[model samples]
Target chain A: MVRVALYTLLGVMSVVMVAPLVYMVSLSLQTEAETLSAQAVLWPENPQWGNYAELFVKAPFGDFIVNSFVVAGGITLAHLLFDPLVGYVFAKFRFPLRNTLFVALLATLMVPFFVRMIPLYVLMAQLGWLNTFQGLITPFLMDAFGIFLMRQFIQPIPDDLISAARVDGASEFTIYRKIILPQTKPALAVLGLFTFVFQWNEFLWPLVATTTPEMRTIPVGLTLFNQEYFTLWHLTAAGSVILFVPTAILFLVSQRYFVRGITLTGLR
Target chain B: MSLSARYARTAYLFLLPALVFFTAFFYVPIANVIATSLHTGPQADVFAGLSNYADALADPSVRHSFLVTLGFSGGVVAGSLVFGLLLALVLDQPLKGRVTFRAMLLVPYLTSVAIVGLLWRNILDPQLGILNRLGLDQQWLNEHPLATIVGVTLWQTVGYTMVLFLAGLQGIPETYQEAARIDGASAWQRFWRITLPLLAPTTLFVSVMAVISGLQAFGQAYIITNGGPGDATDLSVFHIYATAFKTRDFGYSSAQSVLLLVVIVLFTLMQLRAGKRGEVTY
Candidate 1:
């Protein structure tokens, strides 16, 4: 009886957690009139999978998705390269001021990006990099969070493994490339996914950075879509699905990493 | 190649990229923000002392914004503490298919805030929303704006806090619970004495993250209420964005942002101090 009650509780909680997403899909398939009707409709008579395609036409969402992928992917790859290298330096090397430097980086983590927005925007505008991919990609190509998380993972790697490589005349670069990189794959995935998802959902920065529709990211584009077509809930829901799918797929494939990442860093 | 060699030159090589990034992106922007915060003229070239900050502090809008953010963060921390812990305790049971349930719960945390905000806006739409048709026909966004923000945010992030708590719960020695039980302690007593105390660090961590994220909230304000029917949801970040971009008052915006950062750092330090007091060494 207790077991049945437990299952029932979890089952209800799961529905609460998932109902919005399920409703989004259902709403996306409905007609505009059906969506705005006084009575709520859980299912549409006709499923407009065509709404997904029409979303592409209503806006350059295809380009926006590609922009999101490029910018987010570019930032993730940069973090994967530099963060671990930095983490290895902090983890293995006993440099003077190492702790000070590490703490300095961590301190920046406390300073939210919004605090730096005005000047960062002006700085970009000064460089005439506004509305450009480089403007969106370059500034955040590195982050302190990745370095912090990577250091946590790399600290547990055995010292003797690196020592063995160094005794074999392996340069520091090769040791980091071959030993630390492979060992920290789990950390890398965690960092990469969090950074990618964070950047993909990034709205304010992209909205501030890119003025042209050509450079809009999915989140920014979708916000504009909702604003312009406030009554068109079906179309807006379709756009939400498009914005949501890649992250959903990522979570499904790496469910363990997302949970582990939260426990590891509580990163958002 | 000796491990004892003092300060390897190659270590700097590994750190060079990060150092460059911090200097250019992090440190420089910080310097620029502070410098801009000190100026107040129309062109913003004229140097003004603390007047911009003084002006911002005396402004009712700024004060209201900070209060709204405080209420929002407080609600989020309180809600997450209660519901998130409850969910964690439930999931910690040896129930069947809990992994799948855990995954389902975490989907919102994995989702974008923009999407989450828009979804809630649709659900709670006054005229044609599902909730109203289902009898929650109140003016949700207008009448109870902060609670509405808290509700959606908890819906999105309770899973995150639950998972953290679950990790903390799993880390506790099982023997402790068993020992308490053997001593004839009731399940509730054991939870109150043993489990909750051990979960302090995780609880602190969750509160700190939730508060900091809450104070800097923007997407919900921008998308859902546009800072609201009458500035009820005018959160700090949202207000700062408007003061900077919409009002074109960069000097004042920078001042407000600096103030917001000080508030975040202060809250974090206080929590860390309290966390240290509550920390259990065992």
Candidate 2:
């Protein structure tokens, strides 16, 4: 009886979690007229693939996808290249303000994004960066959270690896490239995947920073779709499913790394 | 060059990019926010003292927005955590087809917040929603505004919080439970005394994350209710957006933003304090 109850609970929770996503896929494939009808069908009676086709053909969705790709890609590369390096410096080097710098990174975490959004907007405006790809990419490139995560992962590595590389007359850059970077591959992958997903799904900042249709990322584009298709349930669901595909693919591929990232969150 | 000097140079080289971004994006903008809040008028380059904050405080809409934010945040945090913990406990038991169930549970967490908002808005729409199809034709948002929003947000987030708890539960060593069983403890007693105490760290983690996220509850309010039914669910972030963009009151918005920062920071400090207490006891 106890076992049955537990299974039932898990089953119900699983359904609750995935039902909306399934509903999205279902609605996306439905013809406009069918979707609008009072007769609700869990699965579309006829699957029309043209919704995805119209997204690109009629709207600037292709531009949105490209913009998202470029921005998320840039942020991921920046995080992977810079995070571990800074993490290494903070972890290994005996710099004068090492502790202070590390503490500063942690301190920034406390200042919620709400506090910073307005100022960030003004700063972007002042720099003439608003409505530009630079505005979308630069602010997000090197997250404090990524740096902190990398630092934690790097701290546990033995110092001997670095010393041994140095003893063989490796340049400092060479030592980092040859020794530290290779060893921290797992951390880098996790950080990269995280930065990518976050950049892709980000809404408020992109909405605020970008003005033109060209500058909008996937989330903002989807928001625009929502606004334009206010009463069109099928199109809204289709847009959402379209947005979900790349993120879902990325999540599935990097799920193990994603799990690792989640594990590290509990560490601090 | 000496090896130590070379390494130092390398370290700084590695640090430059991240430091530059952080300074420009994080520190500089935050300083700008502080400056803008303290200044007012056409240029906003002139300094005015405490006027914006004073105005923000005096504005009833701002106060009402804060209250609405509090109500929404409170409901989301409480509802998600309770349901999440219950689901986690249930899933922790060894069961058939658990892996698939676990993956399904994580689907909600992976779904974009915008998509979640859009999906739920339709799900609870007074007229055409599937909820109506089940013969439960009620105005989910209009009738019980806070409850409706909270219910949807909880539905989206509970799975996420549950997975986190499940990870924490699985981390607990089996020996502790075995020892408790040997001592003739009842299942309830063992859970209360042994399991709960051990789950402190996870609880602390969930508390800080949930509260911080709760205080920043904007997406659901923005996409679903649009802070409607007469500002019933206007979160602070939404207010900041409106004040800055809609009203063009940059100074006033900055001050309001500062209020949100203060609220979150205080909650974080409180969580840290409670977490530390648990650490000491353990």
RMSD of each: 1.9, 1.7
**Model 1 lDDT tens row, A63-118:** 89899999999988888888888888888888778888988898788879997788
B1-282 per-residue lDDT for model 2 (tens digits): 985676667777777876787787788888988889998875566688999889888999988888877787778777766787788888788777776776677767776778888998888887767767656778868878878878877876776788778888898888988998999999999888978888888888887888888888788777888888888878778888888898888888888888778878888898789788877243
Candidate 2's C-alpha lDDT? 0.80
Clashing pairs in 1: none
How far residue B55's Cα lies from its native spot in candidate 2, in Å, is 1.7
On a 0 to 100 scale, what is the lDDT of residue A65 in model 1? Answer: 88
- List runs of model 1 lying over 4 Å from the truth: A1-5, A266-268, B1-7
Evaluated at residue B214, the lDDT of candidate 2 is 82
Indicate the DockQ of the complex predicted as candidate 1: 0.71
Expressed as tens digits, the lDDT of each residue in B177-268 for candidate 1 is 98899999999999899999999988999999999989988988999889988999999999999998888889999999999999999999
Q: Model 1 scores what on Cα lDDT?
A: 0.88
> Model 2, A98-118: lDDT tens per residue?
787778877888877777788
Error of 1 at B128 (Å): 1.9
